[model samples]
Target: MIRASGISLRRGVKVLLDQSEFTIHPGERVGLVGKNGAGKTTLFALLQGELDLDAGHLSMPESWRIASVEQHIADRDRPAREFVIDGDRDLRRLQDQRAATHDDDGQRIAELEAALLEADAWTAPSRAEQLLAGLGFKPEEWLLPVGHFSGGWQMRLALARALMAPSDLLLLDEPTNHLDLDAMLWLERWLVSYPGTVLLISHDTEFLDAVAKAILHIDHHKLVRYKGGYHDFIMQRAERMQQAQIAYQRQTREAARLQSFIDRFKAQATKAKQAQSRVKALSRMQLLAPLKEDSSISIQLPSPTYVPDPLLTLDKADLGYGSTAILKNVQLMVRGGGRIGILGMNGAGKSTLIKTLAGQQAPLSGEKVAAKGLEIGYFAQHQLDMIDPDSSPLQHLARLAPDVREQELRNYLGSFGFSGDMASNPTAPFSGGEKARLALALIVWQKPNLLLLDEPTNHLDVDTREALATALAGYEGSVLLVSHDRHLLRSTVDEFWIVADGQVQEFDGDLEDYRDWLLSRNASARADARKETRALQQDDSNSVDRRTQRRQEAETRQRLAQLRKPLDKQLGKIESQMEKTGERLQELDLLMQDPNFYTDQYKDERPQLLAEHGELSKQHTELEEQWLDLQEQIETLAQSDH
Candidate 1:
């Protein structure tokens, strides 16, 4: 357990924590949350002993080992796997000592080997590989140098290195920022099973809720603890705010009443005694200030002037780069007011599809159809970097709408949480979140009928994410979003499309269902790989007599066919059912588009329609999982026969 008693911390002239006291029990996954510049990162530095507290003490077990992700990687030439293995400092030190030992020192070498075994140093490479795979690195990329990857991919390696360490406590700051949906879900599962305590600082509300057992918030120059996840924190905080507001209102009313009485009597000598008593009463009262809510940014996407049906369409689209087709036989339609979320594994052509739809990349051999006056607003991770560092938010807006008044542009920037000097200041020094907001503000300022957003919430805080979701919900334009933020997906998008296996198809389920499907697919793929390895070994052993080999091969083929036949049949049935579910979902979506379906007159019928949609979605998910299981079983049977 970790305990803090009467701690005081300051940075420059600003006080971050004042007499703060808290205790974190062993194995508790605690989330640290605060607004920007509220000193959450400073608190992390203090905990890591990089910064000293001004007063009081912090205590923890002396024997406990701690591990954290390094923000900098200086050795670019090192292999990624080796860099991760080095995270186990003790293991690395033992290896170094063994390397320095003299050849004749048998006794010392034996001792070192025993120590290495005790530390599980022999399995370090395999453990590091697993971490890399879970963080979305391909098998072929494991041996590559750390410098070969982009900045975001390098950050993933840093995260993998932290997870590779053997420690009693783990500190992760925004681990999911560089991860896609599949990798993020994998990390969530890994953290849930991790034996050590976790101290996570992240702005992703859904992730925090999924992994954290408790929440620690910084408010009003004090640290406050809450008993549960992000949603629980919100509920408890809202209640506290309500109570505080009530007390403040009551005190203000009483103070006003006393002042009124004193004001009316202080001028008259006959009521001087009454006035003096009222004055004393007012002076004795302790005034309570109103509770201030957390500040949040509000985004308002400009409405388009014209919204036509069938805003865009892709006919037999083959999407990829150059001659390589990442996705084929794709057919997608975007109608007015449609909201769709794209789901897929990292590098599974999600971005390729989005780029094709946004007209940034042309389809290899198919036609992209757009309405006569269709306008698209595309938002992607690269868009943030495209912002002119020397330009302010106001300047960016002016470039988009040059005829508009300067004051009008400033007012629009203020709605997205940039006002006063911030709107006028150059964006070069802004944090990632600010840059992302500015990029999104530029996109939102354009009144486009179709919006294509890719990972738009990458650097946004919880408040900004909520605001974005709310704006998307209220916008009259159609939107296609690809994001790992499950909360935003669940709240904004009505349906999802999955990109996988060189094909694009409409997914008939929700985010939870997509997670289950990903797990099943991974299991099936692993089983297939094992089966392939066994077959390769069988092929290599041709030294046996030709007659004997031929007979064995024939028997293996017969047995494998028998084992796979039933599984194939089941897979066919599942595929058929999934198709039906997809069609039904599309029908329901059309029904939902009718304005009268949401009116008071048809409220009674709405629940039945929603219930049917829910039933179909559940069935589709179960079928997909079943299909994956059957595929894995067939692969295992084939390996056994070999």
Candidate 2:
């Protein structure tokens, strides 16, 4: 167990943790959460012994091994797998000793070999490869030089290295920031199964919920611990705050009564003793600190002046860079008020699709039609780099709307948490979260009819992420979101588009279903690989004739296709019904949102409308279940064919 008693930490004059004490038991996965500048990293540094506590006793097991991802890695021509394997210092030390041994030292060599076997040195390469694979590196890339990969890929490599190391405790900071949905899912499974304590800091609520057994939140320079995952912590914290508020209110009433009595009767001879006693009592009373709500930032996207239905259309388009088509024969339509989430593994052309739609890249073939007065608010990581570092948020907004008043621009920036000096200061010193907010502010200022966001929540903290979700939810425009933040995806997108196998298509399921599909697909691939290896080792003479084998395979495929045709037809019918039911639900939702819908004028029609809505909703759910069942069956048949 790790314990901190009366720990007080500071950076210069700013106090981060003052007399804060918290204990984390062995094997507990704890999530550390706070605002962007709330000293979470400082706490991690203190735990790592990189910083000294100004006042406190911090203790942990002296023999425990700790592992964390390195923020910087030397650029070198080292094989990625080798780099990861190097994380195991013990194994490396054993290998080094063996290499330095003389050939005549047979006894020492035997002892070293036994020690190597004890340490499982022989399997280190495979273990390293597994970590690399889990972090989204392809098998072929395992042997590539670490320097050959881009910075983001290098970060993934660093994460793999950390995971490869044997340790009693692991510290992960935003581990999923550089990961895709598939990689994030893989990492979650790995972390959950890890037999070690983990202290993680992440803005991803879903990730926290999946991996954390407890939450350690920084509230007002104090460490507060809550049991269970992030969601449970949220509920528990809210209840605690509510109870605190009630206590505070009761205390206030009592204090006021005592003060009132003392004021009214202190001058009277008859009640002088009582008044003095009350004053003494009041002076001795301990005052509870008032609950101060943290100022939450919010954004308001200006409504577009005009919204055209079917805002953009891609017809048999080939989306990619230069001559290579990452997404072939893509057919998609973005209509006004449509909210879409893009889902895919890393390197699966999700960004390419978004870029193509945003007009950052033209299609190699086929037509991309845009409706008149079309405006797109495109945001990607690269957009942050486009911001003028020397200019203030006000200046950036002013450039977009030169005719708008300076006060109005300042007010607009304030909504994004850029108030006073922040709005006027140059953006060079701003943190990633601030820069992301500014980029979004610039995008919102345009009042675009369509929002094309690619990982907009990457650098955003939990509160800012919630604010963005809220703004996107209420915005009167179409949205195409590409993000790994499941919470944001669930809140902002109504439908999903999956980019996979060089094609983009509608996914008829939610994020959970996508996860299941990915798992099944990976399993099938492994099985196929095993089968291929077995076939390769068989004698040629024992194998069936090539023509006969081909004929049998063709027959099997034909039978499977014949069996699937009816099911496919039925699935199509169900999908059409679901679409109609979904449209009706949307219509009902719009009607219910109207304030006048509950008025006396429409009182008689309300019941009928609600009843219809309930029936449609039930029907939609049934259709969805059926759709998922059929999809699973189709996928099974497809896997069998493979």
Best by lDDT: 2
Candidate 1 per-residue lDDT, tens place, 1-642, comes to 999989998889988888998899999999999876778888778778799889989988888888898999998899999989989999999999999988555556545755786798878998998899888887789999999999988999999988988989999988888788889988989999999899998888988999999999988777889989999999999998899999999999999999999989999999999999999999999889788987778888889999999999999989999999999988989988999999988788999999998888899988889998899999998998798999888988998899999999988999899999999999998888889999888887878899999999887877888899999889998999998888889989998999999998999998889988988988887688679878978877765788998999898887456546656766788899889998999999998899988999778989999999899889888888988876776665566665
The digit string of per-residue lDDT tens for model 2 on 168-248 reads 999998999999988999999999999999999999999999999999999899999999999999899999899999999
Evaluate model 2: give its TM-score. 0.82
Local error of candidate 1 at 393, Å? 1.3
Candidate 1: give the clashing pairs: none
Q: What clash pairs does model 2 have?
A: none
TM-scores of all candidate predictions against the true structure: 0.79, 0.82
- Give the winner by TM-score: 2
After superposition, which runs of candidate 1 have C-alpha atoms over 4 Å from their true positions? Answer: 13-15, 250-287, 533-642
